[model samples]
Target: MLKQTANMQSSNWIGHFIKITAALTAVFILCETVLYLTNPNNRWTLVANTSLKDGISNSLVYPAYAVDVAFQDVEEYPLTEPLIVNPLPNIINDVVLPQNDTFLPVHLVRFYFGLPHGDSHSFCWIDCISILSIMLYVKPSKIYIHTNYPDYWPFGRCDMITDWSLIQLVYTRQRFHLSGRRITFYKHEADVTKYSVAYQYGGIVQDSDVFHLPKMVELLRDWKNKKYQCLLTREDHFMNSGFIACPKGHPYTHDVLLRYRDDYRDPPVLYNSADVPWEIYNKNKDYQKNFFVDYQMGNHSWDYKGPIRYKEIPAWHAYWHGCDENEKNTVQLAKNSTYWEMLHFILAEGRKALIAVFPTTVKP
Candidate 1:
């Protein structure tokens, strides 16, 4: 009878141990999920203190890897991913556009473009010229060209960095998701960073399509001479980002860029690259009095109304649909601007097919 009692006690002890082990495992998993949701940027909190006045690129964990992580993992972990800013190259060559990156409190300008990791592609000829032209037109004290392919921008006129990592770090640091619904895309990467740069550095952030015009040149020069904390122009409703200027560490930029996700999530329309920053302006009161709705500053090369002013001088030009290749637009383009000038682009691009089919004769 004593032996039988001992066997029963041993079996009960084994069952209790199994239950304890399973309970501990469940607890561990629950704790991990909580930690991930609460502190998505990780325990490090690297970008929380990013005054942005002093870039901490030197401190990026693995400079290049941060960009690689953005490209690979953005779709999976949009808001919570941790990213590092790649270090800027030590030596900038002379051929670069502007001589210095003033890193000034204000009068800085930034632009963004998407390219493959390296300089392997044809690197669209119009984009090359248009981008360089926009920078010169702004005449900024400091210029930042945000791109995935830094290799192509070696000339040193602009400080080139990976915008992908920049935007990711901003979202994670700001906890931007709480603002409402967070959406990520090829265009948002450029659009969001424009806000970040304006908040941190206090400068202009323009689109790649814009070009130099006298009005834009005058405004940029004004920032250098005296007291202009920030300047943004808007149409009746839309806030045009083609030209924006701000004082370094502006409160407006902080609220719009960082705290946005905390209050409102739904924008009437997405802030896609083509449209304006209307979402932020509409939601935030601080932005209204500080920024203005100016016709000249917000003027487009071609308005929704379509009284084409391409031939005339404007603050900045947006060749908005330079890519439109419809057969009908071909003749209208010739009437509006210099369509005949681009017939060469067609021949240059289709040379391989043209040669394969008509190898015997040269077109007379």
Candidate 2:
């Protein structure tokens, strides 16, 4: 009887232990699920069922990641999603063309076509974006682009595109021949930075991948001639390097070159080399090398900087450039259809606004 009683007690204890372990596992899973849902950029809907409004609150925790995930989804799957972007009118249906008497703002355009034969792929997209941006956001005097294929520009849409402005050190007859890799990626971008310094035009230079938003010109106008050399915007989670505003010839462009040269000499010494995070970019030697390191003196200026001012107008915008199989599939799909339409819709609206706002007193 005693042996039988001991056996029963042991069995009860084992059962209790199993039950506790199972309960703990269930709690852990539930907590993890809740955490994931709270992240705005997690794309929980892609994996589980969730509404965007509910996701918005969760987005506060992982704001950058949440935004990136949300934008990526919107950019890729715009067709399935609603066309209602709050606060901004839909351009496709309500395009506002310029009236008979009004002129447009002095246009400012720049291009980034670093990839060779990238003109057809990257540069072509940039030209379209530039035209669309000029039409929608601000009136540019002329959009200047730096590419090997200037012949491919849509001259019908643009008024004119003059010759290249900056000195071409890499492609010059004998100045300094760049390796194929540099030509493929960094050469044209470096040239654009130089051009921004050399040209006195107040327009910003941008990479081909940028997508413009409404009120972009107003933002630039607000920052004109204050002593800050360069201005940039934020993207989903980090600062977008593209879309910088400066006079035709800003002095800091030279600083950019010096930093680039130093970076080349010591790969780990500069900001965000071809491969690294912003943490590396901020603390690197290049930051010190820059002439405009003083924030008070107004050397480094950006629309969004630091943790406090994170929600201002995005200075550097991010598009659906995806990584991984799932993300790539979604990104490519949206790039084909929904992305262009929404972008064009925004552009059309902006053009009308530009026409209404363009300076009538200035000469064409």
Candidate 3:
């Protein structure tokens, strides 16, 4: 009887061990499947983390707010080593076709803000820092700033930026049928219009909040020589609309505008401004050939390997919800050594740094 009882006990233990092993195996497979289905080309996807140490990109971040997946299996362009870029300055409104070495000849750096006055303006010093950074690095022949409050901050200060002027940028708002209702968002308007405006005008369309670095000068200059028609980047899983550059009359830029217009021509909008441009480009073979991998040009600069060329809102523009957390992040990044170094330290330390300095109830 004792021997029989011991035999039964050993069998039960073995069964439990097999069950646990199978469960763990299934979990591992599920995690890999999720990663495979989400990223393009099965390459690295930018997952948000506090630091660069460890393989965070490969790990499942499983962010509560982040579940949106886009354009799976699409091959992404690769960014070769940085070359010495030179922005061939074209005469504003009179772009000269290069007789010999006319690559990406664009001299106008354009920025637009709908409301520049009253409490609704929402332009803060952090915003100013980004714009100032762009102006200092890009070194464009002419800077065209379009704002409702032409008399406000950056308009009259031509001396502040290298070259500055005001242009009347007006757009008739269009309604989109999204989430079972007609909606009009400023970002949506900026999305389609940016392509249209940039195509005709011939320049770089930059957001007011896009921070620039000195290293970007050479990269942009080299891009001109490479015959790249347009350079766009991804913010997380979607192609970002906040920053884009194109020489005058680039076909890719024109096609993107047409696609966006056609998609919303009727009803039931599928993609947002950021996703729309990417979808259009992904279908085109020619555009892919001229593409470049730009880690720094993206909304999240610290995710990839490069100098932090641009500064953007971490998750979304509305992530902070006016709770002062955004400002805290901005302030934190501004301190210490180079912006890159400061950002690296903050990301590595994660919530601890936030708690130490700007102790908040908010949890990362």
Best by TM-score: 3
Please give the RMSD to the true structure for each candidate, in Å.
15.6, 22.9, 21.6
**Which scores greater on lDDT, model 2 or model 3?**
3
lDDT of 3 at 36: 54
Ranking by lDDT: 3, 1, 2
Off by over 4 Å in 1: 1-123, 148-184, 264-268, 271-292, 296-314, 317-335, 338-364
| Alpha-carbon deviation at 227 in model 1, angstroms | 5.9
TM-score of 1: 0.47
Q: Against the unseen true structure, what C-alpha lDDT does each candidate score?
A: 0.42, 0.36, 0.45
Model 3 error, position 336 (Å): 5.9
C-alpha-based local distance difference test score of model 3: 0.45
- Deviation of model 1 at 105, angstroms: 9.7
Task: Give the runs in model 2 whose Cα sits over 4 Å from its true position.
Answer: 1-127, 154-202, 225-229, 234-239, 265-316, 319-344, 350-364
State the TM-score for model 2: 0.39
Tens-digit lDDT track of model 1 for 1-364:
9999999999999999999999999999998778555542333323221222333332232211122111112221123322221112211222122223353322212222323233233223333334434433553344455443334443222212111221211121222222234533334444555665554345565654454443545655555564344566665556665556665545555445543333433353344322435666666665665554446544544533344332243344444534334334455555545422232222232343335556675341
Query: After superposition on all CA atoms, how large is the RMSD of candidate 1?
Result: 15.6
> For candidate 3, lDDT tens digit of each residue in 16-52?
9999999999999998788655533233324322221
Q: Using Cα atoms with residue i matched to residue i, what is each candidate's TM-score against the true structure? A: 0.47, 0.39, 0.48
Q: Among these predicted structures, which one has the highest lDDT? A: 3
